[model samples]
Target: MVRGIRGAITVINNEEQEIIKATERLIKEIIILNQVAPENVAHIIITVTEDLNATFPAKALRSFEGWTYVPVMCSREIPVPKSLPKCIRVMLTVNTSSAQADIKHVYLEDAIHLRPDLQLTDRHL
Candidate 1:
């Protein structure tokens, strides 16, 4: 079976380091929460808001020891009017046995506003 785990986090700046850090943190939390193994991840799609263009968000995954072979693509998010800024969103497509409803979607920092219905008690990770 195939399933997608969605995640998003906001960065304090458009700088490469901040974007990379936020992306890494977001994906790490999603992996921990979902108990996902890198080997099972089919691919990852990372999208950044229009205001953030320092670097590709996919660069964050390079530091992961087991994710060297994982396929990843980075792109710009559609610029909607009055949308969240400095945000990075990720869609991790994986081969999993879990049902769709069992998948946990992570939204951290200001990005939580993008999906309040999916937010947990914690503010950010």
Candidate 2:
């Protein structure tokens, strides 16, 4: 079966390096928590808040070792009024046997406010 693992993070600015670094950090946390392998991944869908267009978060996954072949996409989030700003969200689709409820979704930095019901601990970083 395939599952979608979601993760989000907030960056300090819209700069390329910061966006890339923050996104990579978010992906790493998801992989670590869920024990995801690149070979099992189908595709990654990344969306950034409308304010964060200075860079594509998918670039971080490309630079990620062993992720070169994994399909990834980037888009802008619906610009809803009062929505979180400078946030990057990722939906990782992977071939996994784990049940949907068992999948680990990550929220880091200020993005934690997006899903307090999930009860995720603060990221070590």
Among all candidates shown, the one with the greatest lDDT: 1
Candidate 1, residue 95: how far the Cα is off, in Å:
1.1
| Candidate 2 global CA lDDT score | 0.90
TM-score of each: 0.94, 0.94
TM-score of 2: 0.94
Query: What is the model-wide C-alpha lDDT for candidate 1?
Result: 0.91
Q: Which residue pairs show collisions in model 1? A: none
**What is the per-residue lDDT of model 1 for residues 20-39, given as tens digits with 9 covering 90 to 100?**
99999999989887888999
Worst 10 residues of 2 by lDDT: 116-125
Q: lDDT (CA) for every model shown? A: 0.91, 0.90
Alpha-carbon error at 5 in model 2, in Å?
Answer: 0.2
Q: After superposition, how far is residue 114 of candidate 1 from its true place, in Å?
A: 0.5
